[model samples]
Target: MGRTMGLDYGDKTIGVAISDELGWTAQGVEVIRRRKPEDDMERLRQLSAEYGVTNIVVGLPKNMNNTVGPRGELCIAFSESLRESLRLPVSMWDERLSTVSAQRTLLEADVSRKKRKQVVDKMAAAIILQNYLDSNSKR
Candidate 1:
């Protein structure tokens, strides 16, 4: 089966992750610097093809109160765009504090600040994807 792709979309970047063939785990791929909507979609399309992605899971940044804010709305819009452009089923998973968790994991790994900055988004994407996979497996 093709892998599930995970995305962490932000104002400046879009982090990418992909599940293993078995869909048991996730790995950080790349952090695409955002330019234009079409450009981002094109890059995502390339990644999807390269990784043989069957589906997409986008990280939705919700507030602590479990309500979607402006960022979450943006993610929802992005996901809609992805569905139309990629013609793949797109799902949005709650991603509150995913970045924070990534930062913590990086800190524990003793990664330098500059290096962490470069990879944090991708790392967060992996975490978001892993969480989704784990939850689904338990179902």
Candidate 2:
């Protein structure tokens, strides 16, 4: 079966993660630098093909008050674009604290600040994907 892909969309980059074949866990892949929309789509298309991604999950960073903010709106738009361009089932997961959690994990592991900066986005993507997988597996 094809695996699920997770994306942590941001202003300057998109963090990527891929689920295992059994859909049990997620691993950080790479961080895609933002450029033109078409360029971003092309990169995603290539990654999808390479990883046999059948589904995509985009992180939606909502406000603490349970409302979608400007950032969340952007994520929704990105998710729509992914659905149209990739022709894959795209979903959004609440990721209000995903990045923060990633940062905390990195700190706990004693990752250097420079290294953490380089990898936080991808780690956040993995956190988002793992959260989604855990919730869905309970169903």
Instruction: For each candidate, give its TM-score against the true structure.
Output: 0.98, 0.98
lDDT of 1 at 55: 98
Each prediction's whole-model lDDT (CA): 0.97, 0.97
The 10-residue segment of model 2 with minimum total lDDT is 77-86
How far residue 27's Cα lies from its native spot in candidate 1, in Å, is: 0.4
Q: Residue-wise lDDT of candidate 2 within 1-139, one digit each (tens)?
A: 8999999999999999999999999999999999999999999999999999999999999999999999999999999999999999999999999999999999999999999999999999999999999999999
Report the Cα lDDT for residue 14, model 1: 96
Clashes of 1: 0
Q: 1-139, model 1: which lDDT tens digit per residue?
A: 8999999999999999999999999999999999999999999999999999999999999999999999899999999999999999999999998999999999999999999999999999999999999999999
Q: Which residue pairs clash in candidate 2?
A: none
- Pull out the clashing pairs in model 1: none
